[model samples]
Target: MNQPHQPSRRILLKSAAATTAALAVGTAAAPALAAPGDTATAAAAPGGFPDYRYVKTLLKPSQLTYNPTGEIIFPCIRGTAGRLSAPLGRYYLYYAPHDAPGGICLAYGDHIEGPFTEYPRNPLVANVWQPHYSVSHVSSPHVMWNESAKEMWLYFHGENTTTRLARSKDGITFTYDKVVLSTSMLPAGTTETSYARVFPYELPSKNAHFVMLFMLNNTTNHRDIHWGWSADGRNWTFDQKALVSHNDVSAVNIGGPHLLTRGGSAFVVYNKDKTSGGDLMITEVGADFTLRRHLGRFYESAAGAPDNGRSASPSFGTEGGVPYMVYESGERLQGSISVARG
Candidate 1:
């Protein structure tokens, strides 16, 4: 958000299958340079669902509520690269703020359109080295309400080298449950790990399942966003490994995936950093959970960020019976909670 100062650091597992659960504070990876002159257009299809209009800015430097913790926004997620997970009556928006150096916190929002509340004992998470995980930046959140499991599942890519998970009955105030799937959880042939995302594909399921898709950073510019499946949302088994790749050469840092279903087909939305800014790209997934078509670019960031992911989709059942997106915007303005609707 601030003039991207480099982290002197870059970390990921030996392979992409290894992952870590992020939502802590202070931890970060060395900012990589944007792939030059990329992202003029989407390579696959395009993210063309509906036009996303700005709803409101939730947290910002000038508008933040000050509390005793430090600065009012002091206890926010540093990465702001987060997502919105709404069940029915409850809404939880995760924030990645740099509470301090090398720390990341999981901030929460009750209402999608909000004067969102920052969790009281924020920085609800941190990355501690475990044999199962590799230490690194624990940020970039994607949350979901697992109806079948009757539990709230939080997923994010952290320093551990892959996207990891922890479960909670209540969305906020979570307990570190366990990593959903990693090299350890896989059968074989998939051990490479790194920080990535795994969001639920919003298709009404009879199979009692969930789908997670996040970037599998195999290389600096050669990362791929892959998918996985789960029966209980606790233990996930691998599905299609590589879902999308850099078919988009005009863009870079292009992976914060959001999946929503319409007409029995699921639409996947992601972002492409065009250096000038970021644009939301969309694709479709069939009932079988295989990649379908790239719709078009849905929305574009004003200042445009190549670092963070702008990956939020529309919830038709949200208040007002309209649709809205809880995504990170104002990245050029130090990032904050923002809502977008068609």
Candidate 2:
């Protein structure tokens, strides 16, 4: 397989610096316009929000058994594992295995922090021609159990340009459903759509129950998180306004959205491109689903750790009343998965 393009260190640093400068200014003020239909009247808490720090490395690329030779695979650099807790105190982790035979793979463990065992039948979803008739090089699997559908739903992107959906009775095997959102669904000038986070959210006013936060890539190549709502897990209606944008956070690029709710309040966590390093930033989600306030950086690369330079692609879950985050760190392909808690 051909090597995926890697940005030079100089370019990466320059981009990070630009993002830092923009963040310095962008986050200083509140957004002038609220998301359409947002009716939030409450101000954000003045401080004392839960701050998360890196705990330890969870899984590295070398640990995946997809490659018999144990070589680090391309595109499988940083992990995007969608974690789910099952009965009997077991857990399932679904992720794209960026090996020679690239596809989505699964791992099982008895604990959240685990010596996870890769499923014997790996590559649960293969890099085959998709329903859209494009050669599929898929990654970034975000799995959720849709109580409404009574089955597991796997949302993923292929080639980092199209977002598609699939369903499974069990978490391991899946069947393609349809393209929920993609560039073709966007306005004429838009370039791509990817990195989707779908979760069950109760919209008290609209009487809806599901929300999607996804990255939108414009013609200029800037990425931002946009909001969408669904009554069921399938069909959706997107708001043109972004939940988080370059103007709001001084980020040239932003994506990797994850939502966590605790004690009747919701929090949105996402990655922002930065000069020091790309890190996760968070904000409160109001009852109306509009982002309430910027809570600043949620997690950054540890000072001298293997992931010290960059971190991105955050996934959140709770087990035993403890909140845990799984994310990718370091450069793509060389990056690994790390977990943290509040």
Scored by lDDT, the top model is: 2
* Lowest lDDT block of 10, candidate 2: 1-10
TM-score of each: 0.64, 0.76
**Considering only N, C-alpha and C atoms within 3 Å, which residue pairs clash in candidate 2?**
16-274, 16-275, 17-275, 22-250, 77-333
Candidate 1 accuracy as TM-score: 0.64
- Model 2: lDDT equals 0.61
Q: Top model by TM-score, which number?
A: 2
Lowest summed lDDT over 10 consecutive residues: which window, candidate 1? 25-34
Model 1 lDDT, full chain set: 0.46
- CA lDDT of each prediction against the hidden true structure: 0.46, 0.61
Tell me the tens digit of each residue's lDDT in model 1 across 1-342: 112222211222222222222222111111111123322121211322334456566555344332212221111111222222342223444555433222234444434456565445644555554555556445555555554565556665555355567766655555566766554443344444433444454334535366776655443544455677665666666654466655643454555565555545566666564452465666676767665565556665554342253333222213222234555554422555555543
Candidate 1, residue 307: Cα displacement in angstroms equals 12
